[model samples]
Target: MLILSRLRAYLRAVYCRQSFFPGPLGVFVNPFYLARSALQEAMRDSAETLNGRLLDVGCGTKPYRNLFHVSEYVGLDIDSPPARARGVADVFYAGKAFPFDPASFDAVLCNQVLEHVFNPDEFLAEIERVLKPGGKLLLTVPFAWDEHEQPWDYARYSSFGLKALLEKQGFRILNHRKLRADVSVLFQLANAYLYKLTERWPFSARLLFNATVMALFTLMGLLGARFLPDNPDLYLDHVLLAEKSA
Candidate 1:
C-alpha cells in the first residue's frame, strides 16, 4: 500500500510538469495522452507569435507558462477553491468581469476554458476589452469531449460555430485548426470509458489495468492514424488564433 501510494505520487508529480507534453512513460500511463499531446503541439506552434504583457485566463497552474516568449505573463482565474489550491493565479476575479484596466495586455491565452464559461459573450468581451488593439488571442476549446470540470461545464463548439462566436466578439480569426483529427480520437475515447469503469477498483489494480489498456489502445491508435483517412470534421478540439483589429 505504501509503495503504491509513493508510486502514484511520483507519477502525479511527473504528470503535473509534463501534462500536455508527456514523457515516454507518461505516453502509456496517461489516458488523455493522445488529445493532450495534440494540444501541446498546437500550442507550441502558436507560442512564438505571442509576446509582451500576456494574460492567461483560467490559468490552471500556468502549465504552459514556459512556452510563451513574453515580457510579462499574468495568470487569472475565478476565485474558487480549486484556483486557490493550485496557487498559480496572480489575480482572481468574479465570473462577470476582469479586474484589469482596458487594453492592458498585448496578448491573451485562454486554453481549454471557453466551454466552462457560462456567459461566453461577456467573457470574450472582457478579453477584448483587456487586450490592446492588434494583440493576439490564442484560444482553444473542446469540440468532442466528455463533460468535465463538473457542473461548470456548459458547451462545446464546432469549427464553424467557434469561428462565428469569435468573429461575433470582434476578433479577426487568423488561424483555426482542428486537433486530433485522426483515429486516435476514437481509441482515446475508448480508453477513457474503460478507465472510468475501473474507478471502484483498488488503486494498484486500477493503475495497472489502465496502464495496460492505454498502452494497447495507444499502439492501435497510432497504427490506425498511419493507415486511415483523416477526418478533420470530427476532432477533439479547436485551436484558434485571433487578433483584435487595430
Candidate 2:
C-alpha cells in the first residue's frame, strides 16, 4: 500500500512539472485522480508574485502550499461539515464577513471557490478588503463542471463574465487563462456521468465499472481531439490573476 502511494506521488510530481504534451490522452492521464496538474502548474508559474503574506480561501488540505514562496500562509474557511471533513485551515469563521483587518494580505488564493459562494459580490468584496494595495488575487472558477458539494454550488463563470465581475469589484485584470480544452471537458463530463451512474453498486464493482468507462471515454476524447478544432467556449474552467490598485 505504501509503495503504491509513493508511486502515485512520484507520478503526480512528474505530471505537474514536466508534462505538457496536452494531447487528448495526456491530459486525462491524471495520476492523482483530480486532473489538477495544470492548475498546480499555473500556480507554480506565479510563485514569485504570490510571495509574502498569503491567504488561502477554501483551502483544502493546503494542496498547493509548496507551489508558492510565501512568507506567511493563512488558510481560512467556513466552519461547516464539509470544511471540517478536510481537516485543514488556520482559522474557521461562521459569518459572512472576514475577521481580518483591511489590507491584511499580500496575496489571496481562491481555488475553485467562487461557484460555491452564494453571494459572489459580497464574497469578492471581503477578499478585496483584506488584500493590500497592489496585492494579487489568484482565482479559479468552473465553466463546465457538474454540481458537487451540493447546496453550496451556486454558479459557474465564463472567462468574460469573470473578468467583468472582477473589474466591477475594483480589480485590474492582469491575466486570464482557460484551463481545459474541448477534449478534456468532454472526457470529464463522460467520466463524471459514469461515476454517478454506478454510485449504487457495491464498492469494488463501482470502482471497476467507473474505471472501465473512464478508459473508454479517454480513448474517445483522444479521437475527438484529432478531428475537432480548439474551442474556447467548451473550456472547463478558468483562472485569473487580478490586482488591487496600488
* TM-score of every candidate: 0.94, 0.81
| Candidate 1 ranges with C-alpha deviation above 4 Å | 1-8
- For residue 216, model 2's alpha carbon misses the true position, in angstroms, by 2.7
| lDDT tens digits by residue: candidate 1, 1-246 | 999789889866765655567666766667777888888889999999899999999998887899998999999999999889989999999888899999999999999999999888999999999999999999999988888879989999887787788889889999999987989889988877876788698766765875787778877887899999999888888999999989
Note the residue pairs that clash in candidate 1: none
Clashing pairs in 2: none
- Model 2 Cα shift for residue 217 (angstroms): 1.6
Top candidate when judged by lDDT against the true structure: 1
Residue 65 CA displacement from its true place in model 2, Å:
1.8
- Model 2 residue runs over 4 Å out of place are 1-35
Maximum-TM-score candidate: 1
